[model samples]
Target: MKSLISRLCLYASMLSAIFWPQPARAYLGSFEEQDGYRIPLDGQILSTFLAGDAQFYLNNIDANGYTGVVPLGTYPNTLGDGTHGADLSRYNAGEYGTNHSGPGGTAVDITDNSGLWRALAGGRLNEDVNAPYYNGSNFTRDYVHAYRYSGARTGSAVLNLLASETNLSYAYTLDARDLNGTAPSATAANLIQMAFWLCPSDWDDTDTDNILGISLRDAMNQTVFQVGYTGDNMLQYRLTGGAWQTTSNRMGTAGWSELVVILDTVNNTAGIAVSAYDDNTSTLASQTYVLSNQSLGLDADALTGLQWDLRGGSLSNGAASFKNYFDDFNFTVSPVLVPEPSGMLLAGLAVIALLLQRKRH
Candidate 1:
């Protein structure tokens, strides 16, 4: 009997070790895990950025000719292959050694549905290319930057999908690197609200009822699906009935968090997966959150656009500003499968319970 008890204990321990959840390695997708210079030219639009670089894609289509924002300056109507039209000035170009300190220039509040702006950092009045935005390092590498401008702001894009594209999947890596504040270390200064929204084809930028600068409540009332990150570090989503719901786990304070949203219009459901990496680029096991098969608000055939919003938190002046970094954006017609708790882990727990009961007898 003693020997049987010892063998059972060993088996349970080995099973637990094998089935326990582990941290996931960081994934950078098409973009490199490096820093980048601030976008040189002021008010540069995403449409032109797509026309210049082929690296960005929308629903498997090369990111070019998509219309959502106003043109910043003179650009070639016809762009050649490669990064021809996508130089630093056309994109985020600046002098290699110049200290770019400016209160005005390319930085503009996106009020007229002008899409996203490219800058070195956010929540700071000075748009300095050499500003150390992350961990005492200058901003480098290529990623979309989002933050609160004059009011709340959203980096938006329009999706022109094919008729055959029924269901949709969208994904991006988000780096909630740091928060800038006036009081510096005040507790209220720690948080800023951010969210991602999936909108239907009928989403109009010109709607008078639409608060384009900040909230998406009007859009959310439509067929839009939303995933939100609160100041408390919790991940929340919109239910089919139009109310917001939170996941079981909270996210990490800093690092890259990958969010994938799958919209299934045929089944009237949507799903989301949220995972974050530590400063070391390794996944934080405690921050993984997934909500699958949530109900949708309205029955729709297709989704046409998406928006990412950032709102300022706890601020009287320069203090308490937040920045969100996005990269490796993807969209497709195929289905996406989010990771869930393992069945083996549950089985291992059951075995341990049975063994303990026998030992007590």
Candidate 2:
């Protein structure tokens, strides 16, 4: 009798398994996964409910996809004036410079800021790239890392958004150190804050009303959503003209900090998550914060571009200049998840119930 009961339970389990639905297959390619999340490809249909997805992989200096070749020396250093002058001119002309490219393979027509942006190799002193695993776990082959110079007056990488993309998710693997590969003093003056901005595509710089400089910080304060570090090593976020609310996580520790942000334009909300992998203690800390959009500021629909804004008041200590390293910068239209088939679920439950009743008889 006991053996009969065991056989009936096994049959019921098989009935449920046979009726279960399978998940959608992920896009397969080299450098396709990051931090356990699959980076979407251009024109790939992630869901019929939303538009196709797109991704920008910052794996090479030329902005092309990784080609199994390593770049040499610091980028834009061999270019005009060696101070990024030619590239600066291009940026002023609404370009991404000859050396630095924008997020979407082409530059935007607007000048958002005058920050110095370039690319650097991995495993170098003052900048340590996450090799073998870019996010300390999933993904690899990140030979180049994006550098936002702390010495520049302002630093940022901006890109235009897709037409039907109501949601945006970005990931950056970051490691901060002085020129000698040593941990820099965690002083308030040496703090570096990197924030994301969702603003209008026509965001102007040094416009007719302004004379000398355009305050990127002031402009960021006017966007639909802003989320990033607090410069003092805490994660914080805010809506336009709203007070910044802090999360429970601390960033910019000893080793690499993997950060991902998901923005919902339809709801005017954002979710910021980070996983800090410490090199010294070999430990990992993860935290997340979800900010709801209770009040709307500027119409989120008008906000068509994403901007990475960095600010560092004092970046140098003695002879060593503090460098902020960012790698594997990825942006994709957030995919709408498909719900499980309810009819199949009910059928499986019915099969299991019928099997149990037969055993009782």
Candidate 3:
């Protein structure tokens, strides 16, 4: 019996060594992981981005046809072709760099209902644009409406960003409403809301209803985060799971800002970071939110059920309308390895048994 027990102990020790658990490594930026996919935005077709190389997809739905310094392919007349349509050409030419009418010329016609709505509804993963607004009508039946505008008549534009993969991910949208009177609230269902960060720039005090933030329902129309803005000229974050958790680490002076929320799949946690600089800035502020199994509103089995919302209030005294611009939206999934707890426990027991056997011998 002693010999048999000694052999069993030796076998267990070997097995433990083979099945030891290893600590997870830190995940780098959006697409820095070796195993993760990287989709380069070089004005290529959507098919090029979805050729199976990118693990995450970043869609920038621009209605004014101005995609910043980047020159992406133009979707002509609801078709994913390189040709520029009449509606698209109007804005495409009036955009910043392009030369259509003249220098500093504004493209008012492009901002029309047909041009903007067509781009949103026709957007696709790598080849098309998904139109989120209604044509010739401000009201939408199924999707959310996102728009952007400057202080002037022709300074605003609207855009949408879609993830490449079909999985449940977290995202945040900033609606630039004219908070001169009261705060705004809109229903956002079928979205895994993380938090609403608001920066109120120019608005009157009577506009207490100018709510800068609020959380919405999860991807399955479930409530996850709440919305509340900090005092005018400040930034705020609100939690939605249990008790309402709030935080204020204002990052910018209050205008068009970029709020990024990412899921650290490798560490099984999530984090929210904001950057306002047009270029690079080290002063970017970010807050880390640890996610527990129960706290993750969605179940393990149900992935790819998340959605986003970008509509809520009125703009220009509820006359012109509110508009917001978004770009460079990306999401990544980390590779998780199962740990062998049983093997570790058995290894500890074997060491004890081996020591006792040696002593008896």
Candidate 4:
């Protein structure tokens, strides 16, 4: 009986050693850094959202929320001066430069004040500032000075709004000219923008000349969720190789829908999942696509559409452009787990065996 009890104890100890959970190691990547910029949580101060002046920007708010703009600096351009035209001139600056590149040539600045109907206003023209002309053309006129506010900017009292909402939303106008220019190289450093293609009406290969809607040049490689455009359009997600895969749902043209994509760096796979949601329902509409063993070796720079010849007709004319809006964009460096070798598990088992032997003796 004593020997049996000792054996039982040894077995229990061995089981625990084999099944013990390993501690997850810190994820090694850009998005995982503690100081990395991220969307603010709800109820946080608006001043904290800016790169500087956490308190000053927050303090000047009136009961109605009227603060001034906080300059984010310039937008960065990679191409040579005026190569793609003045439409692409905005890229000559840095990340937050005077020239806006997406929809119009509008540069966006943030404001702590919500009382003002427009949170985003345009910067002065190059000639107005007497800045040197990269392009010799006199077309560097700045117009369309409008104030665009984030979704958070619209909610709450001007003062309370800054203090309460932790996150703000913003969108800019974009045009075909922005998409027609060269695509930048992809690296670990840049944050690339990605889009999904939904083709509901027909998959006619001739009509298939349309480029995938997503564009990423200097974008950080993170998992992003995208929604399929309504209509008879088939939902497609592109991987690094430029190849696309379809989703399960046959989406209709009723309204906007949602899809989730997980970009795994370890396995080199872009895991895609789709779901359909309506303003009226809490139940999720979902589908999953597991794209494994993808050999599409798309370099970061190549994904920008710089090298590929534009298609003919509307696509060739650069008018049949793809448009997408991203919200709640998020990415996380998955914590790494170092697995204990089988030898370690055996060592634990040996120790348990000795202890049991002693107990029996």
Candidate 5:
């Protein structure tokens, strides 16, 4: 019986080692990890410091004159082609980076409205290229830039596929700040919400179910984070219906910012890191948020669902919209150190030491 008990103890120790946290790591939108250690999405991507200016395009279409959105087929993320009418290849040139004979450029356009809604999930801000932007105080050169919008606004998401085979993922942007230079003043009238949706466990991979979003809510008089919403940002994320959690000051820089989430399938956790643009002029830094909510967790082993969403709420001034700008959006997955319950392991060791001491006495 003693020998059997010893074997069980040995098994428990092994299990503890396998499940205990290895280290504490926070992955910004540009970084990720898997199975331990640091791992980045290698190869010629759209635009990363590692890409060496090698343009990021899907290289599978001829979308040159296709105006407006078409039915989404399968081009960027699945096993098919994007062609509903007028030879889809013509439209691919602007966004897919393959309009001309070859494929390599700094432009991406997706006007198709079908398939999965995550085709552009891994897009980065102009890759720190010939990027320029208006930094509220002044228009800065050689800085990442984006299009800002504010007002009674509405639009459709044109992506269709955002499945990640590799664990490496990304979500880059120039910045997410008050385009009108509005300060976080009393009774904010404007509200904004931006997020990447992930399908839930029960929903079909093709169904858009879950969402991870950052919202500016006038109702709460602050910005809030979301896990699910009523088809739009105004609803906010809730189980059946309730108030959402809030974050600190929203981003204020117009440099390089991103939202990175490391999906750990085995452990059922996602490490979230959000970095405001890191231009030397901007003092805002990166922050980390842990996503243990069911709606925010990984759908399957792979990121099978992704939806890019942005919406505006009514303002205190009764304004419908406030100008906002964001570019260089990317969302991929790699692996990194994740937090674990190590205190228990240490306590176990202390108990063993006490037992040994008693035996010796």
Candidate 6:
């Protein structure tokens, strides 16, 4: 009789398998895929998603994927100064004093997938050509890990959201660290931030006004969302007339923190979340806040149309300039999840039966 019960437990589990919780998936690479995979940047994601690169990039589409919290790839781009700069006048990757294919300037051997990308937001760009990785960077894995200087600001290996992207209706987060390779000091004037800007076929520096993002205590208040990196990482949101509002501090610790945002366009609200953590494993002491109809007339459709961007190094303010790194960059459009109350019960029963069998053995 006991043996029959064990078999029945297993059979019941199989019957109730449909209720198994579906795992989450990465935004860039996952839209209709199976569950429990928050970061599914695999073969299909690499070859299928549009790739970009300015400097440091891994060779071959097969070389593309995620490393821990960071995503790597060779994103091919035709606009601006990419890893291979065809025209010198456009805004490039990192910093730039001149054109490509020359001397007395920051130069590197270019590839079909590379280009002349200048440093971003008024900074210098750098990359390692001899190696496979072009820029220190994607989610099909769209999550990217960027540097404040070399392999980051100086180079770009981006995934094109135009080809593979989700709407603003998802939970997004960016985990950041100071250049020291650890949590940022709350006292330090950390200048790093992630910007999402309109990627009209013709994107350039002039589009700065169209970009907005989150950061750690931007003294200049570069964007609407920011924090001072203070105790609890106080959250701040900019108002219409440049005024600012604050909320309970986010991220319990100081070293690292995540900036989370969930866009509710239909209701004109933005649910922002943040937390402190290490090694990109996960964030700690998370917090969430809701902002309604406070977008200063900015359209949510435009926000959804923007591309993923990583930038640091002075946005032109020397005081703000500091080395920083970011990881687990995600922009998603999550669907309403279905429940499995019966499945949960069956799963528990299965576990209990397995344990009983072990004890009997």
TM-score of each: 0.36, 0.35, 0.34, 0.33, 0.33, 0.32
Candidate 2 lDDT tens digits, 149-177: 22222232212111110111221211111
**Each model's lDDT:** 0.31, 0.29, 0.29, 0.27, 0.26, 0.28
Of candidate 4, the 10-residue stretch with the lowest lDDT total is 157-166
Instruction: Please give, for residues 86-200, the per-residue lDDT of candidate 6 as tens digits.
Output: 1111222122122121112322333422322222222111222211222443112221222111122112222222111211111122111111122222212111212121111
In model 5, what is the error at residue 299, expressed in angstroms?
6.5
Off by over 4 Å in 5: 1-95, 98-112, 115-242, 253-257, 277-281, 286-301, 312-315, 320-322, 330-361
lDDT of 6 at 231: 16
What is the lDDT for 59 in model 4? 26
Clashes of 3: 44
- Candidate 3 has its poorest 10 consecutive residues by lDDT at 26-35
For candidate 5, the TM-score is 0.33
- Cα error of candidate 1 at position 1, Å: 48
True lDDT of residue 295, candidate 4: 30
Expressed as tens digits, the lDDT of each residue in 8-43 for candidate 1 is 443343233223342211111111111222221223
Candidate 4 C-alpha lDDT tens digits along 255-325: 33444433322223233445553334534465444332233244322221211111112332223222222
Whole-model alpha-carbon lDDT for candidate 5? 0.26
Stretches of candidate 1 off by over 4 Å are 1-38, 41-221, 278-282, 286-289, 313-319, 335-361
In model 2, the clashing pairs are 115-154
- Residue-wise lDDT of candidate 5 within 181-290, one digit each (tens)? 22323112211112222211111212222222432222222222233322211112332134554333233323333443333333333334455433346654644443
Question: What count of clashes does model 1 give?
Answer: 17
